[model samples]
Target: MTVSSETRGLAVVTGASTGIGAATARELAGRGYHVLAGVRRDRDADAIRGPGLEPVILDITHPDHIEALAARVHEDSQGRPVRVLVNNAAVQANLPIEVFAIEEWRRMFEVNLFGQIAVTQALLPALIRSKGRVVNISSVGGRVAMATYGPYAATKFALEAVSDSLRRELAPFGVEVVVVQPGAVRTEMLGRAIAAAGDLPAMTSEQGQRYSGLVRAINNQAVSSTNAGLPAEAAAKVIARAVTARRPRTRYSVGREAALVHVVRFLPDRMLDRILAAALRPHSAVTT
Candidate 1:
């Protein structure tokens, strides 16, 4: 468990296939840390080509993958402590909560929440030994819920809650926990959610018909706004800084919009709720 003061230890980052995760892995490497990038596909592993970066095929939802990663990290570190852990993998669901299939909701939680916990638990020893930090890649949705993104936001909200508790519990152990909330980072996530909606049973159900127009408008608005959002690398840099900071913050919002969302957290519940409703409201809606 003893790491030389001069040598930077290993950093584990999940969901390093693309977007924030991939960029974070690269950023950490540039900051003089050995990075184990958790990617889920062969193509993703192939894509992350670098000197200090090593790609591990990791599907966080799978126990086998989690166990294998724990062993791999142990072997790779050679008793050296793990310096950082970033839980950045997530799935998205865009639909009215009333019509969102329970199965799909569960899947989102499995990947975004449960899997994240599993990985963290598996690596807890290494993190504790090194007194390293845990950086969770949450979203602005975690603080402010929006319609049509209920399921996705729900998972993040729960994640933020759990992360808060975990931070308190681990503080005594010298293991800091941090949450990085990004607002509409320029990534394929929004587009992928829209593209996958076509085939979801919830999107084809009767309730879907009733709420289809409202949901479509919300999704489109979200996509259109991405053009003005921060690039994934911006979040990556923030996360990398979190990993190496002498005294890292409990939470960091990476973009202008994310900063706004964080500030709005101080607003009264009624004020915030009204603002979110107005933002998610369809452009053409009947009003009294």
Candidate 2:
């Protein structure tokens, strides 16, 4: 049913076309919030059709779209506080740094960081008035880097910094900012990322010949291995908690790899490099 809970108020979930964002929108809807499910395509809008899910076309990377989104939010909320904003839309590209183009780097940051910032900026006033909270869905990449994920990881790491700064700055306004770092989750995004990795520098190139095989293998393994990860619904549950918790934590780590992430964070640089090399090095060249 279309929700009308006065206490739960309105929730805006960006990238709601699929994956964690779509799951999160449904979660918030079940919890009594009127969900604005943002998407880029008409089909995606249709996909999320249901009670409490009002699909809107929102391409966060475009300035005009962001402004229109803000206006729509303002109107739907009827000048009231928007209780939650979930910045869950993002994309990933996997390629060795040498094989990655400069424009690719810009595009990653534009969608993952800058676009998120724009949406938040436009909605800050509503958040402040409602004492609302913001939920940013970052990835384990934000905390740990892996081969062929440099460009994507950079954007997430930058997002972590942004979330930290915004968390402290918004404290006085009663507007909470929380980061939910998910290790991995079962979603269609994994397939798309693996498929897109094919476009990296040609295997005939010097650098590509040295690393492309290993890079593709490792990328495939990373995606396929994580097939056992929690469902996107699990990550959505965490985002929901962050939005509704009376005193939410600054960061919440989801998935079984949280302990591993801690180890990666505290290990010596030399030890960490050795570990990564052992795992990521070309298989035929290694021996016990």
Candidate 3:
């Protein structure tokens, strides 16, 4: 398991434009690997500017981009090796699962699940050659069901399962697969997700009345809770370990809340539901 400085190859990190992905890219680059910062915009590439950091435009949903990346990797590596892949691009548009838009749900799946697969498949040849590492960035939502965020969590759950299967499948070939489930982190995604949740149309006249109050409570909770979670840089440090550790774990849970949520997942469904309902009850709704 000796990885010499010269032999440590390129580490490809998707969603590297900002947040955890960006931090992870910097962390990896600092650790001596040549880093590819995969982002959807050319401007995103500019964000990763520095020694050993290469910004590559990679919108995971685009086949052309995926293919081009593989070609470029082969050329750059010159048959050396690709030592790591971090699948971190994700979007969360929270709505009650019953009323979630099919199109929006599909879009989340495309980036959260299929995009990860597409990138991995394209890079498999190089990873196998190097016996490299694959770190799938899941979330606490993946381990437990949370109301109003089912669409996003479903994909993370699938990612956790897929990471398990891939770990077994790739073990024979020497590639290691690790799943990193971070709780909430201070990132731009929290604000965007909160805004998206508020934009959903009223489901019913009664629900509309219900929705206004509920949305306010949810937004407040999200703002406060997300603000309280670990910083994206801390999560990125965990991701960096997954990438470069000699024996990376199959699953690494980051943040205290993340661990608590995993415990909540094991509780009886009814009990957990009641706990959430009580915990989330709006302050105004608790009048004597």
TM-score of each: 0.91, 0.92, 0.91
Which parts of model 1 are misplaced by more than 4 Å?
Answer: 1-6, 77-79, 202-209, 281-288
Which regions of candidate 2 are displaced past 4 Å? 1-4, 77-80, 200-204, 281-288
Model 1 Cα lDDT, one tens digit per residue, 20-120: 99999988887777788999999999999687788999999999999999998788735556888999999886888887778888899999999999999
Query: Over all chains combined, what TM-score does candidate 3 have?
Result: 0.91
Q: How does each model score on lDDT?
A: 0.85, 0.84, 0.83
Can you give the lDDT of residue 77 in candidate 3? 48
Which ten-residue region of model 1 has the weakest summed lDDT? 279-288
lDDT of model 3, residue 189: 92
Q: What is the lDDT of residue 72 in candidate 3?
A: 77
lDDT assessment of candidate 1 = 0.85
Count backbone clashes in candidate 1: 0
**Per lDDT, what order, best first?**
1, 2, 3
CA shift of 100, model 3, Å: 1.7
TM-score leader: 2
lDDT (Cα, tens digit) per residue for candidate 2, span 135-237: 9988888987877778888999999999999989999999899999988788888777766766654555688678766676676566555687889899899
Which residue pairs does candidate 3 place in steric collision? none
Query: At residue 248, what lDDT does model 2 achieve?
Result: 94
